[model samples]
Target: MNGFLQEKPIKNFLQSMDEFFSNPFPNSAFPLTVKETTTANLIIAELPGINREQIQINVYDHHLTISVNYQELITEENTQQNFFRSSQTYKRNSRTVALPYPIDEKKVKASYQNGLLTVTVPKQKGKKIMIEES
Candidate 1:
């Protein structure tokens, strides 16, 4: 009975860890806010510890996408034993949002400051069509 109890707790712990790692954005590492105005749409994202070159923004039709790619490195060195160890890790994440109105690709603008990414997409002008009945 004791062995059974011990095994059950260990199994549950492992399962919980597996679920956590499998879920994307488990800790809300990437959060985004969108605001729409009469003339344009604005997107604000919080990306701490990331550089401007590591982020990519795309606007197509009514969709907006934000992608990030970065690398992390860890190094350990010991002079007495002459031992050195290094490890590199690469991480990539992306999020996409659908806007209510079509965007003007030529006028899209983005800026990053103080770990905040702001994107502005202007609304496309609509053309009116006239129908004539004969």
Candidate 2:
């Protein structure tokens, strides 16, 4: 019984690692939150050190996609008259979210401020269906 339990846990751990490595954008993943308002659905994404010009937002087939490409610069100075300069260039990341309710593609709007990306998708009004004789 003890051996069986240990084997199961190890198997589960290996499976989890495999799943993690299977993702293409493992390091690019960030935090996000979804919320629903009375009139629209809202998605807030936290993206620090990313410029607005480097971000793109798109809506297609009830899906919202956010893509970002940025460059990170690292500089180090040493007291022994040595300097190190390194930069990570053109790193790209994207995330897609499915909208719960239908939205007007033309009315979709997004704003970024203070490292927060806010996307508002206005809900589409559905026509009422009238039932006659069955």
Q: Which candidate has the top score in TM-score? A: 1
Candidate 2 per-residue lDDT, tens place, 1-134, comes to 65764697787987788898887556766778889888888989999878899899887878888888767777666868776666666677888899765656789889999999999888777789999998
TM-scores for candidates 1 onward, in order: 0.69, 0.64
Per-residue accuracy of model 1 over 4-60 as CA lDDT, tens digit each: 646977879878888888885564448899898888888999998899999998878
Best by lDDT: 1
Query: Cα miss at 134, model 2 (Å)?
Result: 2.6
Pairs in steric clash, model 2:
none
Model 2 residue 69 lDDT score: 78
Q: Which whole-number lDDT from 0 to 100 does residue 49 have in model 2?
A: 73
Candidate 2 deviant stretches above 4 angstroms: 1-26, 72-88
All predictions: root-mean-square deviation over Cα? 5.0, 8.1
Q: Candidate 2: TM-score?
A: 0.64
For each candidate, the alpha-carbon lDDT, in order, equals 0.86, 0.82
